[model samples]
Target chain A: MTAPAAVLDSPLRELSYAEAIRDALAIALAEDERVVLMGEDIGVYGGAFQVSGDLVHRFGEERVIDTPISELGGAGMAVGAALTGLRPIYEFQFSDFATLAMEQIVNQAAKLRFMLGGAVSVPLVMRFPAGSGTGAAAQHSQSLEAWFGHVPGLKVVQAATPYDAKGLLLAALDDPDPVMLFEHKLLYKTKGPVPEGRYTVPIGKAEVCRTGSNVTIVATAIMVHRALEAAEVLAQEGIDAEVIDLRTVRPMDRETVVASVAKTSRLVVAYEGVRTLGIGAEVSASIVESEAFDYLDAPIVRLGGAEAPIPYNPELEKAAVPQVADILSAVRGVVRGTR
Target chain B: MSISSETERCGAQAPAPGRKGSGGSARPASRRAGKTSAGNEPFAVRHYSPEVLREALRKMLLIRRFEEGAEDSYMRGLIHGTMHLSIGQEASAVGACLELTDQDKITSTHRGHGHCIAKGADVGRMFAEFFGKESGYCRGRGGSMHIADVDKGNLGANGIVGGGIPIAVGAALSAKRLKTGTVVTSFFGDGAVNEGSFHESLNMAAIWKLPVIFICENNHYGMSTSVERSTAVRQVSDRAAAYSMPGVTVDGNDLSAVAEACHGAIERARAGEGPSLIESVTYRWRGHSKSDRNRYRSKDEIDAWIARDPIRRFAGLLSEHGILSEEGFARMETEVAEQIAAAIAFAKESPDPDTAALTRDVYTTQTESVG
Candidate 1:
């Protein structure tokens, strides 16, 4: 058996988003006996997305538990276990299944602490395989991080990079309130540098993925990748597009986005969630609500998924959310003042 | 009071393992309050002493008076939000907690004031919670349905139907995993039995044999809809057969029957015999909520259920057993009324929650680390 990965400060080896999450799970299981993975098809199936691969064999069925296909029951049990001594990480095969567990998540988990006057807490973690482009259609491909972020007493984070994928999970495990961690379905196989052993990426912080001056593209999940790609293309056109990967949607890094918009004087918010009441509106409002409003050179362009439910067809699906080309066109329009 | 008469009323609905009754048996709890304790034998048939009987009556009485006061205050514009009172279903609520302690956990329904009181919640603080004051259990953030005293083993009541069912299963899971010797009871409305959570949680609990009891307070109606109209199944407990668990339906208006049934189920759960379901057939005396103007049910139907008021039946049982006299019952009534009145005054005098407290309890640590 491989020795549990050692703690190394220096970055070494690259892992895909799926592998990074598994590494974090291994660390959590090995380090803390109280941690358990509760979800459907996560154990023998190695997870529907294969994110929990091989850990079930190592941790045993008790720690890496397989649950019935009842999202409401599984999620509620996770919350209840958290209220007890156990730190349970619940997984939804798809983010859309969270609709079934909304009563437990929104009503029970979110309100338990406040309802009890802070006597007890639900130190629970819920993972969702979110975002579109898999052609999983409307039910499986939704990015519902905004729905969770809208609720109080919940910490919602989107892991874009492999480093943050592992680090943010470890951090959420440390949190006392229920935290919802959203991993983009499209970014599962995407690989990036991840440190060895356990490490934590601070929640509610945004990282500047690519620095530029013409426009600041604040993106989440898979949108961060599209924004970075668009920045690369715009760099050749003498349009230096700054990219800010907004990792956590709730308690957003308003200071960083506002500061970036102040410097670039233009902003383009990108996300895979529906256009109405998406994170884009909040980011734009935060900037407008602050001193960044006066520094805006152009109206903030919100690039979100289409208002309609995603069609099964791949072409229509591609048209739903902002792509690299769409980001480029929006950035070009704001930079050239053509709109 | 006699064995033959007791059997006549409760039938074979007790959780005696081998006991079974005809499907949908509706036993009318004796509405006659004059049946005094003279004809009953003491300490021979039941183990509970005269003191325990008095205490049970007292607890149910307190719940009744407290909720009545809350209703009065609501009408007077003192209690702000709406409250769902279990006035007529006190036995089903209190009887489930007869054998439970702080080591045990109970998740209650929206009509959970009785459950909270029966489980030893402070009446003053509960009143404060209903009034939305700082001294309440939730510090005024959560209203009637969300009121909780976790230290007392009362998990907060849920507003959503069937929401607390899974949490109870999870708690049972924790007890089993930790070997804590703790048991959990989930008290939900009849409507919740139809929800997916109820089915899923029951299945999981039965398979694990985790010490948990699913108690369905079958109050005959969910909001305005009758159980017969809403659900296809004739009996709520029959669903337990799907999970391979023992399902018992008892006369909820009879406190002794509820106690006997819950005590056995809880003991079996604690013995690692998995979960069981108890469908306590009862009725609600009040409207579903403040907005419920009693438009759906006729006054005659409401009067019939009110005739079967659980508090009155228990009072009759105690009187029939010779444990309670007319003067003794009257003194108990006055005592409960004063206690409720004091609680109301306490809630009225309590300060409003500090606005600064609203920011707290959101997370365990760190506001937002920008770096």
Candidate 2:
């Protein structure tokens, strides 16, 4: 299936991924009085990645709150605020720092509504600046979206393009449940055409970035762009590789992957997290567990991060995660039925 | 030493009950006096009307009886999971919530049955939750530790020791931002005072000038660990000074004293003066939960706390003040007992949740349904 073309009501403007996110925050704050932004260094600091640039100035300090260096307390505060009447968007300085606030995110925010027998819904959104590329070492650089996706009652999404970054964020605000948005750091400066007005991209749906028939390449976050690059290389070699960008991780778009796999007769699941128990495993299991299992022409290939922390050295950092070359080779192997 | 002996020492130092018609006033009295003495009137007796005092006594009795009934059911093997009984610490819960209305929010700890009752939760629904029935407060999804009545401003009780502290601060933030005029009270045990969340929440609430009251129910122990062993400060309230908030330590078993301390803190919060910490020094007669074997304390200590039961002390004080007659006290006890019995019967007759609808509340959208 092809990606849905958004209706062009307004002129398209070029926006970096970070600018698009800031635009969404500004829009949310302007439209709803309940929307509040909370994080460390978010106010005046323009956020760690400048994704919330100039929002504090435009919305005031009360709305773009700068919380203390208390991740557990700050996250729980967002949960509490969301539980009440406020719609809070909490940003973790770095996705790796989410380890400090796992209790509130997992135990409280993820299970509060279900535990309370649906008495209340947590309309909370958490922004995580994730993935490795810059010299952030092991602690600062990590793709932890799969960790959040494993939990129920949480909507986890990764917006590869600037268009989806703003659209998915707006959609997450409309959601009643807690949504964890993982914005890749490398994609922050990447510019794309985005709508000028408010728009929403449906969550829990995967978009077909490229169409082919030899093999289906399922990718997430930064890997989506890498798989698209690999698809171009594969097409030159007479390998028609279909690329599916999985937008949401928790409520995964399994139908698109399954239908694509059934047509291509091969699968290559690419993700930035570790290979074992990562989203790739879920995608692979979803296809094998479905009727698409009968259409497999060869064993499914998984292109994932190496079983080690993201190193400080540039070369090791690049080696730690799957690159376009790795996706190209993995897709080639799956299409050619080679071990 | 032992927390019970420390609690006993504090109990011995408490002032004698005030005489009737000595200092009773309809207007709200200043709590600057801190501790009531023989010359000064007891805070509740001096501040509240006879009707409010009578209702306070009734709620105190109801808390004690409800825990007793719950214990009875647990012993009879009717209830499944273990429960944290607030049997002896009823005064702290009832007194702290005495001035709260439906608009005010409260976050409770593991031993939160008293808080739930004090916050006006239905006893039948609470019991039904314990029985894992469909008609319970959480519809049987949240059992004893997570019971909540959002409409009554009772955020659900937390299983983690210090989990609810930050949540209460957030609620207060909401109240201040939305101009709801609602004050939030966070209730936790002595153990929670040492948690990082406690200190962080206190600091945030102070800086934000949020309308929140931190009520530390110093039951002397967080499970098996005593306050003296766990906490560095002399009293839990002393830590509030770090956050630039007024801190007070009161005899938690004394209903009037606990009520008086909380009244001041609640007033301070409502006025947007920022958060205040009140450490209610009390003891639990029962072991921490159903699994406790009383290895931490002695039988003598338990008996001493039982003798200083909050319900008995409050009833005796009410009787001395001519607010409740001995006959009226007995009638109240009988009535509370009947209510508990009826609640249990309702729970027994209530239907269990259907297995097919197990994942009904996982998400509001119901996009992907699977248990």
Candidate 3:
């Protein structure tokens, strides 16, 4: 079950990121009786973002429960259920609402096992439909993966493509500790090839989506696609840019980023979070702290979200976060030794 | 009277008149009189067997001694950090857990030593945890505030107020989903009632009809602020009506009173009747913590509560019923004292945890090589 042998022989089919996540949920529900799907409006209403479409009907309301609009209570219940015997997969309607449940996420779920001297493990998975792009305004569109990444007992992961989304969601179920999967709302409709059966992508592992040598562009979630597009444009101008998608943020894939930085000699971190104290800062710190610092030919550049909150206006929301143009300009600046 | 009517009667009299005296003993004498009589042999004395009653008294004594021993150790500088002592709230802890078996689960508060002991945790390991020894419940990772014996069905004692409320509801949810036949009792104070987690958790439990008992050990103050100053509702249990669950308030100092209320709630929960709110109205004799100066309340109020000490009252009740003699009670106290002394010695002798294994239990599986 650990290896993707079924994935190898099974016919590959294109699935939207949301559909892929739903597939993983369906597979988990069918395979394990202990797996329960819980969230607000996830039952007959098909979830807030329609990620869990018709799961409650197929799995029964008892298994795929529609909890009251109580994030803190619901999340804490998932943690408690995980502690005892159940493997609960909880979904937050939007990542911004996580602030309401931070006590359970940060204090209880993250620290329960450690606080109890490893006597118990919380095999809890929380899916957050994160990032801005939808005109959901300041409350619902902010990218807060960095907040969970800062926690010690949590495993934070971001899936850029449909394949990784399903694979990572499956891997999170296999994990014993609490794993937080940050699924970007913008990428939910994006299509990619996903396997038919159960398969897991290792947490804390980065994938080099596009390989080059002039500069390394480290990105996560939606920014990974932007960085890849920027790399394609950079290749046309004879500048070879490497794009590395940092899958996990807490137990960060520092070795992969460090090695990529060592080979490229210049680094550009592109993320959708705020500029200060964001994922970019952590990636940059890992590079400088490692032996890869000696290979640097230019100062590192970070293409992150603006310091302001995500606005209701589409243009302002697009300007608030990094786009393909921002990643391209940042990578060009790093490669040309201008940053 | 029926248990429901009795609960309603007590619930209506909450914030018991003359609770705050003007520099003198304003204790409510009528509420504490004739609790144990030949005809009305309190709920626990009548319902429980003589052996169970004896055990309940023993556990109540153990809780009291454990807190006293912990306080003594802290005073001697043997235990580091601060502790919220539950010295005077022993009956609420023990009575509420009187019917619970080893398989039953409980989530405790910061002042949780009583709950931990009542739920059958070894005192030796609890002491070792206070000493920060490797042989402790949490292997020195969690001290007094976070002590837990998971295998014995104690989830943990939460440092944050109302933090364990939702977790307890979740545990009850697991019990219902997995058909584990486990009922979870979540212990929090009066102050935690105002927390959003409390309201949210109660509503969830009530809606799902989960087998959980929400035990509020209403010891007046959340640190220094009294319930009257902090809470809008007169009684903590009164808030239960909002969530559509049966709410009851009992004299927490009376072992049978608390046990009776909790027994009804626990039985209701196990029968798939959903959750019930039980407010065990008691008081803490000592200051909230070691740093407290007792400035918030008068010494007379503290003295008045001490006069109605749960352990003494329970012991006297047992003697009055011919379940245990006065000499037997003295022997029980001596036995608990010796046990506590032995526990302290074991804790002092326990080995310190190696610094190298500091981060060993942070994650069950080593996902990352980096700290």
Number of the top lDDT candidate: 3
Superposed by TM-score, candidate 2 places the C-alpha of residue B63 at a distance from the truth, in angstroms, of: 1.0
Model 2 pairs whose backbones collide? none
Off by over 4 Å in 2: A1-7, B1-34
Best by DockQ: 3
Evaluate candidate 2 and give its CAPRI docking class based on DockQ. medium
DockQ of candidates 1 onward, in order? 0.54, 0.70, 0.82
- Candidate 2 on B1-371: residue-level lDDT in tens? 01122222212244322111111211133233235555656778888999999888888888888888888988888788989999889888999999999999999988999999999988999999988889999899989999899999999999888999999988888998899998999999998988888988999999999999999988777888987788887667668778887877777788887788788778888898988888777899889998899898889878867877777777766776678886787787789889999999999999999999988888998999531
- List RMSD in Å for every model shown: 4.8, 4.5, 5.0
**Cα shift from native, residue A264, model 3 (Å):** 1.0
Q: What's the lDDT for candidate 1?
A: 0.84
Q: How many backbone clashes does candidate 1 have?
A: 7
Report the TM-score of the second chain of model 2 against its true counterpart: 0.91
| Global CA lDDT computed for model 2 | 0.86
Q: What is the per-residue lDDT of model 3 for residues A28-106, given as tens digits with 9 covering 90 to 100?
A: 9999999999999999999988999999889999999999899999999999899889999999999888999999999
Give candidate 1 regions above 4 Å deviation.
A1-11, B1-45, B325-327, B356-359, B364-371
- Residues B1-371 of candidate 1 have per-residue lDDT tens digits of 11112222222223222223412322222111112143543221274777878888889999988888989999999888798988889888888898799889999989999999989999999999888899998888888989888988988788889988999999998998888899999999989988999999998887778789889998888998888889887688777778888777777776776776777688888899988888888878898998899888899887877766667767766776677887788889889888998899999999988886775665555485321
Q: State the lDDT of candidate 3 residue by residue for B134-157, as single tens digits.
A: 999999889999999887789999
